[model samples]
Target: MTMLEGVTTRPGGRRPGATRTRVDILAAAQRSFAEHGYVLTTIRGVARAAGVDPALVLQFFGSKDGLFDAALRDDPPVRALVTLAGEGDPSDLGPRLAARYLELWEDPHTGPRMLAVVRAATAAPSASAMVTAFMTDEVMLPLARAIGADQAELRAALTGAYLFGVASARYVLGVAPLAALDREAAVTYVAPVVQHHLTGDLTPP
Candidate 1:
């Protein structure tokens, strides 16, 4: 059901090669956003990448933002996050989770895709609620259960807050201290904070 990178085809591409064409366009779109960021990316760039006509990108996603959303889930990032929340080791959940988050940003292809979504969602008040609700229900609920903790929802929110702060400083604002740290080092520091929220005993007063 999920399309490739930034490309999705409407299924009914029953005609000989319509499906393949749609996919190429989407993949191309993903590449453009990742390399150039949202501001610099264009439909033509994607088309060139995919070796397709520009109209195809528009035909598939309808707009650049639609394509942007599709690109973030190249290999089911959300599903992976949710699954990890349920099954990963409780003691190391925070660091593992942080590492996964960092991996997404480090991908270069998926990073810009996420940045575009975050920026757009932040700018729109309506989308903010939707994004928040999705992260909590899908990610936090399961994460809380994995840690065998009560008040899963609150814990999930706390985890999300921690993630948001780190991501904003390291990626969006490019804060020197935060951005300078490599992924492993960042995870080492971030994991404990996340563990505390998830386990409720990772830190002392």
Candidate 2:
């Protein structure tokens, strides 16, 4: 189960009579993201799986990069994660957000896949676009809202830099000192930054 999501959900697949002609291609890309990890997956393989003309996939998504971007929007962590945040106090949002974010990263199945995608995205245009799109659409939107801030878009992007950086260093790259620290240690240090981002600093006792 992802963060706050039930595991029973499955892709509805293409709508009937849709024949957008690119449906198969999209499905193929989805599987590729899961099986081969983003780095090893290829547009050619996706084309082959779809059993359509390889050029069709290219024409539809514009590039492997374009397909990757679409994938994030299509299948994202937002629904569940947001569900977890439902009806919660805005001021105390930091730890909940941090906990959910960390939970996703720590998940065994999702973690490896996510890690693979992140690694693959580092150099791949398609993968990079996918990563950027997910962060913008899912994580950033609610993060801005939880804080009751205007310019949610900007706040979201700023929060992205902080969160993604920590995820990469601690979970992905496994920085020595940070890796050694416990989750509580992380929550204590990390939550304050999230707190500031969501609810800006003000004079206090």
Candidate 3:
């Protein structure tokens, strides 16, 4: 099944006319999770940000885990990548993924949220686990299976490592050379390495 397949939206809490409140809570949660990660973000923090009672957050989300899970589903970058992955030839998945990944980073709408997720993943254990599981189960496994690659799981891990490393260096850390490279230049150089990880032989170098 797809990673986000069965995720039902949470109920709008006990209050009537609570849609705006729920929306505010969710937006606050997103920024909080992005800024502080799972470990540091709390119901009170979210409530403070949303200017709502902490009880309201609890009523809406049930628990911190519930809120985190719902937030992930709310803005799944994987769903977008999955659509791009399935397009064009399967053998070209690496380049396709690279292109799409770059496009996502370049996108103003999605980039901030993705950056938040990445930041949280690096700083918080739960956030890291969430990202790892999402990538392994929702993303890499599906893509590997789609192309019938040998050592599919390993390939997925490797692909993730490569992609994440590049993203961190270029976007987060702002490494000089990599950061300097334009989008086309970045993809041209990185896609082949990604392709090799996806479909190439696994002999040790």
Candidate achieving the largest TM-score: 3
TM-score of each: 0.65, 0.73, 0.80
lDDT of each: 0.69, 0.68, 0.79
Clashes per prediction? 1, 1, 0
**Cα error, candidate 1, residue 196 (Å):** 2.6
Candidate 3, residue 163: how far the Cα is off, in Å: 0.8
lDDT of 2 by residue, 43-98 (tens): 77777666666676787888767777766566555435555445587777778777
lDDT of 3: 0.79
- Residues 4-42, model 3: lDDT tens digits: 233333443454468887887888888777666667889
Q: Which ranges in model 1 have alpha carbons more than 4 Å from their true place?
A: 1-16, 76-79, 86-88, 107-142, 145-151, 182-184, 201-205
Off by over 4 Å in 2: 1-24, 34-39, 125-130, 182-184, 202-205
lDDT of 3 at 85: 54
Q: Whose lDDT is greatest here? A: 3
Worst 10 residues of 2 by lDDT: 1-10
lDDT against true structure, model 2: 0.68
